[model samples]
Target: MLSTLAMSVPADSNWINFDVPALIQNFWSATFDGLTFGAIYALVALGYTLVYGVLNLINFAHSEVFIVGCYGVFFTLSFLGFGPSVPNLDFWSIVLNLVLALVVAMVASALTAFVVERVAYKPLRKRNAPRLVFLITAIGVSFSIQYLIFLWRGPNPEVALTMFRPTPIFDVFGTIIDSQQLVIVLAAVVMMVFTDQFISRSRTGRGIRAVAQDPDTATLMGVNKERIIITTFIIGGLLAGAAALFYVMRIPSGVQYSGGFVLGVKAFAAAVLGGIGNVRGALLGGLLLGLIGNYGQILLGSSQWTDVVAFVVLVLVLLVRPEGILGTSLGRSKA
Candidate 1:
């Protein structure tokens, strides 16, 4: 069945076609799609930034955190009796299901992240292991989670039933805005703002900042390093979970064990593009990457090249400004 579907997808004969007028005609729609996806990337990028900001270690398993959240939402909705065959749901039903899915995904991702930190990282921290050790552990944890899911769920992608049909809400400059795009973009912005404010204004945020600045000084100042580290992982997981829901909403084909790898890589690149340790930089990098990739794909007339386009942008950015658009040196993030 999968092979049949794959074969059924029309090949792009115009892969190299660069039609300026056609691109101009589809500009708004592509931009909207890009921004929506960019929001998801930004949300995932936060996980990278938050963990790196405090621990100075890249949690490569963070991608699995996102994959777990995707499965969480899928299972939650499935339990609610929403599968691929279900018809359109009522308004309140859709809302309730979405809210429940979001909560479940967040909790599941957070717990997964916490476990990864405890089992894979804490021991190394105690031994004061080198950065290479941490990197290997992260990759190991990521693969473990991926295969574990594969063993449990098999290699099939889990598809969700369409709960909310995207309807045109309005039109702008010959571009029709759909419900899904609006919800995704708005929700991402809200979550990003809340996270930024939480990190900047809250007491715990101050402690995280303090630890990021100087761990020994923070410990001497009575800040609980372990607690701060755990909190950062949890927060990162929460954002990844939110992004998972948004991702499924935008592309409901299904969730697979390996689904998060590429998107996670892109999100990581976005973190680097914006300045890895800077929170606001993640947001900027995500949106910018999204726009550039989308435009590039449209111009080139091939969706398969989107990832290539994004990486090319990343390379270009690194070559030009290694600090990222908003990134500063380590321990000097504006957050």
Candidate 2:
């Protein structure tokens, strides 16, 4: 009876005894993976937040815009004879190819955004149509763009160009952090800084804010509301383009019609969680979401829990702070 009672007392009475090194490893891995994904999601979230700040309408097709960016870069690099490894390009040539791919993707994404606004939203805005019409239009536009990719690229996936050389960054604790991750992190930071400066300190930024605050008043003040709207889309699209490059760098797979949807939704969720329309909020929200998502999986010891963690965190944030952590109107009026 005494031996049975002692045995029933529990072999591990403390949670702290569950292997500290493994926990730390899991934490870092989760954090690194989350941040990498969050970086891309932050870019996409900026698009949703910015558009919402100005138009108050979600651009459902924005995900497809990101897919276009990935495809654009992939196709451009492939055309230049670069793949998992390029045999004979000098350093400068490699740099040039990368720059050109980035540029082309950005330009293509910007153009796509412009066309979407012109064909879909412009008519709706002009006719003073119901908001639901805009929503429907956005959904329709999203499907149309997705199907366009399907028709053009087909059911097959294309792989992007990746440098074959292994680097030192991956040597940390058996968790390989690719060189692409470094490049991605740096590029994302630079772009975010530029975006912040543009939005806060530039004349065009002021115009965007004015339009966002009140389009009618902005037009009355000669703010060129049309131009501001176009600029907004361009900015959003450019970020999406950048995100595409990072995404493909990490995954190096072909773009799919629905590939961008998950990212789009996650980014949109990040934006909302961080207080939509607030630039700083988007950043914070993205990082927080990423860290939570990655770490949650580690703690739970299952990859299947990743999506669940993200949604659970989002729901909790919504319930706790409906206004979000930063709680700012950004440029829009509060309801």
Judging by lDDT against the true structure, name the best candidate.
1
- For residue 1, model 2's alpha carbon misses the true position, in angstroms, by 32
Local accuracy of candidate 1 as per-residue lDDT tens digits, 260-300: 99898999999999998788888989998898889888766
C-alpha RMSD of each candidate structure in angstroms: 4.6, 5.7
Residue-level lDDT of model 2, residues 233-285, one tens digit each, is 99999999988877877777646667888888888888888988887777778
Worst 10-residue lDDT window, candidate 2: 14-23
What lDDT would each prediction earn against the true structure?
0.87, 0.79
For candidate 1, what is the total of clashing residue pairs?
A: 0
Off by over 4 Å in 2: 1-22, 85-88, 163-166, 170-178, 332-335
Clashes of each: 0, 1
